[model samples]
Target: MKDGDETRQREDTPFYDHPTGGWGSLKSVARWMVKGRPSPGVLDTLRIQNKPGGHMCTSCAWAKPPNPHLAEFCENGAKATIWDLTRDRCTPDFFARHSVTELQGWSDHDLERVGRLTHPMRYDAASDHYLPCNWDEAFAGIGARLRQLDPRSVVFYASGRASLETSYLYQLFARALGHNNLPDSSNMCHETTSVALKSTIGSPVGTCVLSDFEHCEMILFFGQNTGSNSPRFLHPLQQAVRRGCKIVTFNPVRERGLIEFTSPQEPGPMLTGGSTRISDTYLQVRPGGDIAAIAGLCKHLFALDDAGGGVIDRDFIAEHTDGFASFEANIRETGWDGIEAASGLIRADLEAVAEIYARSPRSIGIYGMGLTQHVHGSQSVQMLVNLLLMRGNIGRPGTGISPVRGHSNVQGQRTVGISEKPELVPLDRLAELFGFEPPRDEGRTTVDAVQGLLDGSVRGFVSLGGNFARAIPDQGRSDGAWAGLALNVQIATKLNRSHVLVGDGTWLLPCLVRAEEDRQASGSQTVTMEDSLSHIHGSVGRRAPASGHLLSETAIVAGLAKATLAPNPRLAWDDWVGDYALIRDLIEATYPEEFKDFNARMFTPGGFYRGNPARERQWKTTSGKAGFTTPTVLSALGAEPGDAVFTLMTLRSNDQFNTTIYGFRDRLRGLEGDRMVVLMNPGEMARAGLHEGQRVTLVSAVEDGKTRALPGMRVTGYDLPDGCVAAYYPEANPLVPLGWHDVESKTPAYKGAPVRIVA
Candidate 1:
């Protein structure tokens, strides 16, 4: 903690070079909705957000367009709907004038700008503040500390802002208290695109849609940053670059919303600032070089299908795939100088992006969390599903493989039953539709729930909404294991630093947000989510509940499952919290082949499409087809970077989203106030003797003798990719290392992490 002691302030600026949803995204949505003044019925609930019975635009999941756009949301979904309909608040005399050790020295954008979160407080470790408490005494002291633990040591988690009837009643109140653990927020970003697309296309989601960006023809991107993490996917890449398609991208920061944008709803390119260019080839690659740039674009599309050049779809790979002769003999025995020194490009630019994916007849591929964080992030998402199944591109239409997800129903909280593995959910149909027996062991992933709260084997934490101590990853070893918890709950709507990191029985509990109005007793309710193309919509809110003492994440997971289970009768839990269509008829009796008719295809319009058994090409894996894996590490940082190291990665700045820090500007890399800067590469900041704005520090190349580092950090430079760097994410999440990650989806490799800088 040295050189100008970090808690913000590093102004730098210059480098935005414009064009991303023009008029600077309508003046950053009119200065973040007049700095979140919200609540004049929150501008009439932003005119029913993604429309059709209105509501689902609690930000990034990017799908909702089925002929929509009378303002079909964007600009960080209007700063996450004016940071969730703000009107300030915080209450209980603002946590009795701040104390949890002085709001732990504030600044996570001033700890969620101290707003919303109205009552249900608790945590007074004798005057450390947070008083209010009631909803049945914080659910009888979090159900008497989860009835003396051991329900697999109690964790729960669930933050894709709840809803599929409060994540099936918070994973059926943690598998009827017998524990299926259920960690969430997609186990920290796309759990390696769900463990490498369910082992190469047996389906773990994303087989295109949103009219496959108007019948593709080409699109590629990787290590995604779709104009600040899916800004409503820049109006389908500006109508697929005005109908000619062709994009391409790869990344190590050539991102300015994929190089050009414009549509603040297109009024003649917002009065002729006329833009729409978007990556007609970008390629920087490097930090964990996406498995050597997806195995050098599947070895130059297998040398253009062995020069016969019909660019392989060899009759849809001889009848819909499976290994392809040891994946074309491991891409013709690899080496093109180890794919140009682990893909920092050049082989005639990967054979000119494999001749624009062999003269595009349809493409698509998109990606994010820079090809899923790293340590070979599930073999770079199974080598981008073996370059979209070498052209048989997973079941037709403008091609497949998307990923671009950032919360907003984090893939519908892993498709309605959060998960901590147990064979990717369905525990014998939720133990015969709720009579019990659901545990099935394996549970705990948010890096094994912060190594089970620093190894006392997790004593109890609940969560429902996120900000889990500023989105996990060794923040001073998870805030010194959050006060050695014996129980800590959250169920939030604001007041974040994981609700004042308290313990020995905390509580918080402020719910109701997807833009308000929840009501119950058989009336006004309507939830459901799921995007990132597995579709299935319906949202509902329409203003008015920022506080009436909140509550409705299905009535606080059915009043904490009627204050911790024991009533059963097939789990009525107060008639599924007074009717959420009886929790979508027990989530269509625990997934009847994916909620068949769950409430008559939920509000239709742009809402239903839940099918994707490998996009109807069927092959739900175990060799029923679509396979081709062959990876053995092409470059998940197994080498290079010997000079003052680097490879950093973290990201998320266009005014943040995931760990929700909505300001400290980052108007597409031109920075602003600050979030501890970094971004390097002006010749690696003069080979790390650093300069431009230098405050330096970083550290963590982890041998674990402790000392993670991340001091002042300023740096700056830019046009990245030479041994790379870049920062912003829970402020470089304390230089990472919570046992690093992604050795097959433990996830944390927050884009690569190896750090070094120093000075």
Candidate 2:
């Protein structure tokens, strides 16, 4: 029960200093399998085969390789699945023992660990506890609230966990109920990627597939922790390394995956008693400084072009790209002085990066939340595309821009009707297929939803899946905003902080997790999900329900639609839940271009890769070409020189997925049993008149006359840029203002919040 200093001391005893996913990964997997006993058989839970026949790993959105290794799933993926398949049950009886107020006092990790929800529970104000309710009664009441309230007053929030079928049904239900307020978790994480890429390459996804690593000569990582976030990704990276493909990483913190990694499944590396060095050159860029570094790369590229004839791809630029001359001029104007000052990197470092970029026949750029979670995040992504377009790195074998997604099927969710902006697709087509006029008005995003709640406009909130209260930014204000809602409904597999913090009338709907047997009236059903690379594949649940009270996400959405969109035989919401193929048929009709061979291609062992015109040199743009954009070079950290002030970026612990806490320990980071800690440089700590493991309050630099202080946070000295620090979030999310987000994407600038320590 010892906290912080004591618990961290326990984790500091290193078993091995080797790279990620070695024996360490195996040990972690084994520990989790047994940690929560009475769970599904370990092998069955891991889905040791391709989905539909089995199931997909319930973790990150890394592409499932065509010819997967003996084991495609990773230790973290196993942990994610095991966490879902827990032994203890959070039944109505368990809720009776602990009141809502009492449960609110528990930690997020403890809330998940207490057990799986066994029944649909309704919040009782008199007893101050959740009481069991039947499905019909709960659905009727929730439907009544939706019917009575103004359509705009309802906020329909979807998470990445829901299947494509469920997401489509949920979105349809919301639109049919005369509202477009579909705010999803993507608004928090990768919305910037979608916004930037769509404008640049006429696509919003990674152009490279899993096999691209084979032909790639060099891979550049900007702000991504590939080792911890996407462990399965290391297989290709390790392969590329063995093939003499150089790996260069730009991150403030030296992640284990980027350092040295031994692929545990690969016999040669794992048994050789040595680890593969992942990064040949690693540069520690300041937090939110990715744009500057990327701009530096572009500036250096132009510098090379000025010196010689061979550096610029003039033919490709003339034929396939737009705005090249202006882009080059902007890069030259920014110059190395501004780039070095903002990026925390010098001219020599950027020049070194450009040398590799110029020399390599094929190169790839990869990044995650670190790059996409900022005020200028969308522009930063376009800047990356600009760098890639310099050499025509996109639309060819082994070369492209990759925005590594954190959640499984997150991109897929957006692909299948989960959007606040209906302009993403043609409304006429949707109306023809569904027999209803789709709402055209712009809806609230995650931030907009919070504002709606605060302003008394949002009366009801429904979540498909996710810890909304914990996962979002501005938690203190958002939690307060939730209190004004008349109804709050959560359809989930497990318990989290969001369920505890609710409105006047609250309902917790216990739903089935991914790949859990979803037996419908038709017999057995399979749901499809699109991966990071947009490969749509079938994922069928094989495990029995955790409790008889559990219902599939698809069924829950269908039931809600049946109740809310009443007296509708033509739509047949009730029949669609009986068989998912009917749902797929409707989806294919709705999006014929994307889901063209919707049913046929899914039978393929891995799945079918959807059309990426950008990858094929087919630009679907206003000018019929890839557009080079002039991204405003906003300084990563806006703070002028004063004291030891630093730009703070929220980080995910090694043991977490979004807001779900697997454990209190971030073992890879050498920290344990505490979330309220900051990682800073030893030199910066000393200069600030602070010591290692010193606890201090952090105050937001961009406070609007209000004190944005996070007290009881411990500062630990480590290696980082002087004006930057890292802290694990949900804990640090409070410091990021709700309105402090990208203008284009509106994603909360979680990775680039300005803060300083107060002793």
Q: Could you list the CA RMSD of all candidates, in the order they appear? A: 23.5, 3.6
lDDT of 2 by residue, 591-710 (tens): 888888788777566678877989999887778899998867646443433566678888887888888888876767666777898887767777888887788998888858766889
What's the TM-score of each model vs. the native? 0.35, 0.96
lDDT of 2 at 174: 90
Span of ten consecutive residues with least summed lDDT in model 2: 1-10
Off by over 4 Å in 2: 1-16, 47-52, 638-641
10 residues in a row with least lDDT, candidate 1: 1-10
- Cα lDDT of all candidates, in order? 0.80, 0.82
After superposition of all CA atoms, the RMSD between model 1 and the true structure is 23.5
